[model samples]
Target: MKKSILVVEDQSSQRKIMVEALQKAGYVIFQAGDVQQAIDLINQQKPDVLVADMHLPNGDGGDVIREARQLPGAPVAVVAVSIDLAILNQNLTATYQADAYLSKPFHPRELLKIVEELVGVSH
Candidate 1:
């Protein structure tokens, strides 16, 4: 089966861009605009990968990441995205148990590459 991904971003434009790129790459994609929606989707979808923005509407992406980890069958990979370089520089993988981190304003190719690396997707 095709791998599935959950993208949790508060910005509609950013979220659309990610969803489109991932969809084009042939992965099933689910999206959420806030922590609540992200958690809901995480529970319902149980995606293979998670791409979340650090800052969200109701809460931070860390909350979503933690939720995913607690699921019975959590996502295989979790990537945290943020505009704040400080957050990216920190060891978030240790704190949140994320698989990777991406700074915002990055090219779609960068996002694709990271997801591919995490999920072992070719192309």
Candidate 2:
């Protein structure tokens, strides 16, 4: 089966772009605009990977990571995104147990590359 990915980003346009890129790469994509939406989707079915943005509307990436880690399919490969906050760097990988991360204003290819690495997807 094709691997599934959950993209938890608050920005509408950004989410659409990432989702499109991932779909082209042949991944089943799911997305959420806020913390509640993310949590709801995550509980229903765990995605093979989670790409979460740090600064969200209701909550941050930390909440998403922490919640995902507790799910049955735990230790879900996470790629946390932030807006050039050095502190977010330490938080994503360390505190939240994310496998990878990205800074905002980055190329879509970069995020896709990290997702590929995390899920072992080959072009």
Q: List model 2 lDDT by residue over 19-79, tens digit each.
A: 9999999999999999999988888878889899988998888898888888873458888
For 1-123, candidate 1 gives per-residue lDDT tens digits of 899999999999999999999999999999999999999999898989999999998789899999999888534589999999998888887877888888889999999999999988653
What is the C-alpha local distance difference test score of each model?
0.90, 0.85
TM-score of each: 0.95, 0.92
Pairs of residues clashing in candidate 1: none
Can you list the residue pairs that collide in candidate 2? Answer: none
- For candidate 2, give the lDDT of residue 79: 88
Off by over 4 Å in 1: none
TM-score of model 2 (CA atoms): 0.92
